[model samples]
Target: MIQEMAETLDDSGSAAPRLKQTKQNRQSQILAELNRSPSLRIADLAARLDVSTETIRRDLDELTEQGLLNRTYGGAVRPLSTEPSISERHHLLVAERERIGRAALPIIKGGRIIMIGSGSTTTHVARRIAVELRDITVITHSFGVATVLAMNPTIKVLMLPGEYHATEGANVGVHAVSFLAGFHADFAILGASGLTVDGPNEALIECGAVYSAMTMRAAETVIVADHSKFDRTFPSRYAGWQQVHHLVTDKAPSDALRAGLDANGVGLHLA
Candidate 1:
């Protein structure tokens, strides 16, 4: 029966090896998204899976609590801080990142001026922009972001001047802020170390300083983070609830936090 199934699939332009790989990949993708946002609402999971909400809720609940997720109003979401090395980050939560990257792609219109913050998620967004968006201008303090976008010749890249942070691979300090102040961008994609019900937060004082400068100059700002970051507080504060324009998180937000952001006029985009 397995042989016959493979033969049938082969006739439909998918060989056994390819078909099996595709199935494995699809499973991996779903798992990755779940890992990124363990506490995603059931409705959000159904939307992502194209299935009924009940089914998703049941399946997610059965998977033992893996520190990756926490129960929410309807489903689960990822945790705030998962310490993974660069390679590990790339390997895990891959499907979720791809979905996030795709969703963010349309926001980066061709020929528009944009600025990207540093982090694993931001780095993925930058790479996707390089492949999909064209004839644009990007100013970033992240060495990784600049390198990722450097593949495109037409897209002008500006590396902000500042002291380098080894772990973040991004620039910081007065020089970075000074360069950002001179030019305005149509959009800004940023990341945060900690997420709270109130607003975006960070751990480093220098990061807070530069992000504040970037926000002031950007016409629109988008905060990208996985759902797990919710309900956590960091040491530094960057933007208050009223300052952000949009937030792209891995899962639907809690009602209270959602209401808080809405009350502050920040649009929420749950991926």
Candidate 2:
């Protein structure tokens, strides 16, 4: 019987793991996923990491207790402040931003001039835009938007002069608004911190004036936002919904929101 047992153990290959999954390794992975998205579901994390649900639950519990993440019903999210920094927002709602960026591409086809708004979603648009024309020109206040679009050798980048907000990685203030006064564009692509029924709004007072100027200078306005922006209001209102010709987003708005968009003649493009 001992000889048979020894032979069976040897035939089973290796009985011990070459590398073990430690608590530190699991916690690092959990934090990484949270950084990539605003929220991460426990079940999805378990499936991706090849761990049991109970194991993931325990990991989340420990992480939350350490103040690294905040738990929702079944998921975890980054602990955000009243105003999250640009670095903090860069990876948030990645899929939603990609879809919204693709949806807005048609609006830029055959355009001579385009104005880009400053924000992470608009930054995604700058990255995703397929440059078909060599003579196309882009105007903006965002350092990030300018840097991304500059990757295209054929496109001309016009950066507005203003006071730089280190956190936003963009320029804003009276100087930016004044510089925008001298130019005109065929279309203005704007991003908002919040999109209420009344209009598009900005959380940062610095961006409010310059964004308002951008909207006024362009002939057409398209607001690119994820569903997370809806029903939220900020103090500074940049432009009314009637001024917004198009709204591109990943999720459908509520019936009340639909009526508001209809009343203002804003075309909602579901990505």
Candidate 3:
């Protein structure tokens, strides 16, 4: 009888720790999903995690108290001030970026020079270009983009000179912009932090200058951005809608943004 009582006590003690561990794991998962997607609805998260909406709400509450995320009306969003590093963004929205990359491929032609800007989405485009196209030259200030295209022996990569931004994994400075001015490209494939009615925006001023230079030197400008960027505005407006030739994205733009694109004659390619 004593043994049975002791065993029951032991089981109860272990159960508490196990429950705590499970909660911690669930919270970790919530953060990971938010990293992949900037915002998450409670119902969607609860459904995906196989938990009750109440439980998800509690987790969100704890995370918000810790300042990890901001709780919204019925969901949570990543902190707006915290921009994910390029490496982190590379893992986020993989499928959507891949679709955008592939859709932008038609803009590339053989024996032509293209300038690719730095961003997770642009890196995807570089990967597609390296595998599918040959006998072309790529001019880029992004170390990541240059590295991807270098794998294709037939494709020549020209690296621009500038100060390197470690987090962005790209070169940005007066030198990079000046170097771009010396040469023109058939297409400038770029990425933006946001895409609103005003235009494509960049978070970094130096990067914005590089993009602007590329657009000016290219025959046509292709902006590759995911749905997360739609209807959003950033600090620096790199180019006006009239300067952008094509926008390759995973979803349709908002009504106002679409009107702006139409007015400026920007081609919308939905991936």
Candidate 4:
């Protein structure tokens, strides 16, 4: 293909000089955007670049694979750092996470007994549920989620007893997992460090077991993450693509992920 393209050009000729220039310009603009803002939201980038969010995700993936950028749960950042922990993630993409939370609201209709895992995004869901719904029994390992839902007197919040991890603001230990094994929850609403076609992933090994236990007890499982988590991966994978029944995100996933979800019969909900 390279030889054919070169033969089609004169000493300094090409079929699509303008096209090459355009691609180069787009990539350059992306670099500029990242340099200016260490962490750039994929949706915001798409809007600024006048393209779809999926396009931005694709571009970011290519760049990250080439060591040009880093991927986050809801955006991209410089390659120097890993995805921010849940403690630091609340401020990164608050609006987008809130939107995802809202999108996940209606999914709780049939279930008053739900288990919410720990994360900034899941905290948003707990917030929405605290106000939007009533008279529910909520179980969780996340202190943050428990605190938020506690405000609603009508809702019964059960805290799983275990060792508290301050950074994740959640409990993760054998006790918690054992406690969760006692009930078949109506739904398991969870957040992840990253997500891929393979499954939902977690950053810390400690939480992976707890999350896996939660999913096992729940009648249904839903993963709530943003588009930035699409191609991102983490060390601990708790649930497989087949285990997730629903996915809520701020933007559409890439073609491959969507196809995988479809093949696995995973419902996709974009906020």
Candidate 5:
């Protein structure tokens, strides 16, 4: 009787882990299916995973709470592509952004003016620049970028004049674009909401205009983005692939995006 009780306890302990793994695997399968298409129905997932509809619904609810996907009426869809506010995005993909930021440092030459656009990834680049580079002038409309660079006494921060966007913590308007046009820079380091085969894009048209001006005014344009931005397209196509000179990212572009970058002679640097 004692031996049988011990054996039963061991089996229960091991079965708990097996059940946990099964649930995790099921959720992963749900995400994978959603990635393949746009949305996933609970009935389809249940049939495919060989689980009950209730199990799929519970999994979807848990995934939604974790912000991995959005739960719909009878299914789930990929997280909305709409750009999140800077405050929200700044906390997402932090490690990847830091790596991408560090990778961008080599492209900057000392004693040259660089134009930076406003975004979470670009703010990471600014932080790296503050610590790594010196005696460089940074032209930007981003309050966050300027504040980061201000810590380094050697770097000069130029704040552009425009309408201040509180959520983005950046300035954007005709004034900012016109001010940027008046001066040229050695390099332009900008971030993107999404990057696709067509090119890098911004969520806001005002910010896109500022990025567009920076790309044209600089000799070489470097786009800093993470894997999350890959294969995603936004409303504003700030610069075409031909205008972008280098892409500093944590992951390599997809096949279609790579072909576009190659056709345009854009260099890719993976962190």
Candidate 6:
């Protein structure tokens, strides 16, 4: 009986396929999917990875055990509780920024006072505003954005003064927020470090406070971000979904975020 069982096991092709699903290979694939979507269904993972649903479920279970993901009813989701570093986020979605900025252009009317927060994506929005709109006043903490807008003859620039961060090339401090607090804008175009179930978030506490104040002071608050920011959390919480009037992001809004915004009665504009 032992000899016959050994022969059958050896002849079975299933052992080879099971052995092929190594821990390293599974983790890599899971990370790739997690990077693309904040949450994924088991069936979706099976389709994407070309593995059985059971294999994907096992992989997700292992990832959850490692604290890399949180396994839920149907599948798994990227952990929202963890905050990623700002340096880790530089230049992640450049193409998405351009797309988001282009989508935001028509919404920005000419000759209005606009408050732009500093970030790669928001800076791109400033560029679009400078090129498309005339007779506009731009208030920003971004030195780079100010320099670009200054080249346009019709656009007026108002730069808030504060301690400069060499990495971000933007000002952040009490001084910057104080300067912004005094002005009321037609629309505030802000960049977000992350977005969570709670709201739009920022990495720096001071920047979050300033961004929140700016949103409050503006008639409308429009958040411009790439898809990467969605469903992610930051160290600091700024404004909730209700505080935002509109969201401009690259590609269509995911069903999860869209549902959240819809529930809050906020509009979403996909670039």
TM-score of every prediction relative to native: 0.68, 0.73, 0.78, 0.76, 0.74, 0.71
Candidate 3's C-alpha lDDT?
0.87
**What C-alpha lDDT does candidate 1 achieve relative to the native structure?**
0.71
Output the lDDT of residue 170, model 3.
93
Candidate 1: tens digits of C-alpha lDDT, residues 49-161? 56577766556654425443444445554444543334444554567666777677766563399988877778888888989888889988888889989898888999999
lDDT per residue for candidate 5 within 103-191, as digits (tens), equals: 99988754389999999999999999999888889999999999999999998899999999988999999999999878999999999
lDDT winner = 3
Q: Which sequence of candidate numbers ranks them by lDDT, best first? A: 3, 5, 4, 2, 6, 1
Instruction: Single out the weakest 10-residue window by summed lDDT for candidate 2.
Output: 1-10
Error of 1 at 100 (Å): 1.2
For lDDT, candidate 5 versus 6, the one ahead is: 5
Candidate 5 local distance difference test against the native: 0.85
lDDT, residue 111, candidate 6: 31
Using TM-score, give the best candidate's number: 3
Regarding TM-score, does 1 or 2 come out ahead? 2
**Model 4 lDDT tens row, 186-214:** 99999987777888898777788888998
In candidate 6, stretches whose alpha carbon ends up further than 4 angstroms from where it belongs are: 1-22, 25-90
Candidate 1: TM-score? 0.68
Error of 2 at 29 (Å): 16
In model 2, where do residues sit more than 4 Å from their true spots? 1-81, 130-133
